[model samples]
Target: HGSNIEGMLEAVELADGNPLHLAHINAYCRGTVLPEAEETELALKALAANPNISCESYLSPLNGTSAEIIDGLPGSMVTRRCLKTGGFTEDEAGMEAALLSGWAQVNYPQGQEMTLLTGEAARDYWRGQQTLVSVSFAVNPVGPRVRLATAKKADGSFAVDAVSTDGGGIPRNVLLAAGLALVDLGGLSLQELVAKISYQPARLLGLANKGSLTAGRDADITIVDRLQHSAFATIIGGQVCYMDGKVLGRGGRIITTAAGADYVRSQGLEPLVVDLADSSLLQKAQKR
Candidate 1:
């Protein structure tokens, strides 16, 4: 599971005769080598076609972009350095450098050119420089050319705009609080990513009774509120438990004894009966 594609393929072949609950294929994008887009698409299609296989792609935007070194001393100096090295024009290099340095106002769709440096080439570019800038740069002809500004709106809310970042959509859900941080940074919304985590794992595990909210089945529910950006409650097996917000207790008849009391009496602790004085335990038990 941790090795190369050949090793993973070998493992999958070994597991073919058995049941595989989950299998995560590591598709590292090393400057678009090996698992290229075409190869990855084919692999995914093939995997999906297999009845026993469920595949997940761990993609990162950092792998597709060209790397560039920018000087921080001055915009002009950085521009000249980039141009002299035959990597980027003065304006392009200046804009890129400024963007990297927290200045996202250089301009839109700047024609910044940089050698697609990797391996030894990338290392050599940073060897002598005191501070070298490197970013995974992707160039696509379809979308807008300018980088979105990471600024707040007039109402103090974050401006909604798309900007490029690293990592696949998978880790944005299962990685704990870091996932929320990634979402806040415009990587992906928690709700959108959590849905993938909820269903994809179930499908991979081949669990027909779970992974969804439907009738005539165990109540496996994950209640979330879009406004709060968190799971407010969860229900399982017809039991519900509040997680984030408080729910007031309602009036109900207390069950002093039940038919199951005989089973406890058989254990010889005590044949006792108690009122339902506390409801929290009942609430939590219902959730399970």
Candidate 2:
């Protein structure tokens, strides 16, 4: 992430033309960082000036943060920042108040899925969990979010390289739903949306086998219901992993560094070795 406009600029300077993929770019433009509009503008300008810096942003307004309070204060710097953003104290009492007021929502488990809970029940659930749970706040500003996602570079490439779901923890994995809405309104072409969400992301991760429908590409695919604007099914490595809101596949390969391979095997999972030298980021560094 570009944590903020300055953070993004600093990282770019530090990279010095090496490839840098910034995730959740919208998180940095929430008015807390140099006013939302200026932050968005600077972020886009930086991306355009530096093709070495790739970027992604989510569509959700609610952002994930730690609910854990330590020694009377929020444990995470992000949590403290969020509390201040909502005009609350940077303490435990403020978190409780935020939850009670619905400015904060607890991400609690409901059946096998995670759902957002606000109001009294949310505060209760959070207390029951000893404030160790994760919570989300509606902190992302709309204008910056939109601009960051749709900006174009000088060479006609996407300023923000992808639309990523910084979800799982916050449950705002609405990539297709939100992205397709942009396509429907002609803010983005279908191909552009796919390239942002799929093609470029694959490059960021160095997933050479995925991201395309070309003849020999891996059969990793997601079928979306355009009318409903939701994921219908997912196929990974030619196997059905998810269908009809159910996870069908038991296990998936863990892509990790060589040092993590032993731990992954100990957990009875296969690890796909990732050499840092081969990463696109480091490859650029090598060329430089």
So what's the TM-score on candidate 2?
0.92
Q: Where does the lowest 10-residue lDDT sum fall in candidate 2? A: 278-287
Q: All candidates: CA RMSD in angstroms? A: 19.2, 2.1
lDDT of 1: 0.37
lDDT of 1 by residue, 182-211 (tens): 567675566544544554334333344555
Question: In model 2, where do residues sit more than 4 Å from their true spots?
Answer: 276-278
Residue 156 C-alpha lDDT in model 2: 79
Encode model 2's per-residue lDDT on 112-210: one tens digit a residue: 789999899998888888889999999988787778778887677778878887675557877788889888988899898899889877766777666
The prediction achieving the highest TM-score against the true structure is: 2
> lDDT of each model, Cα atoms only?
0.37, 0.82
TM-score (C-alpha, index-matched) for candidate 1? 0.33
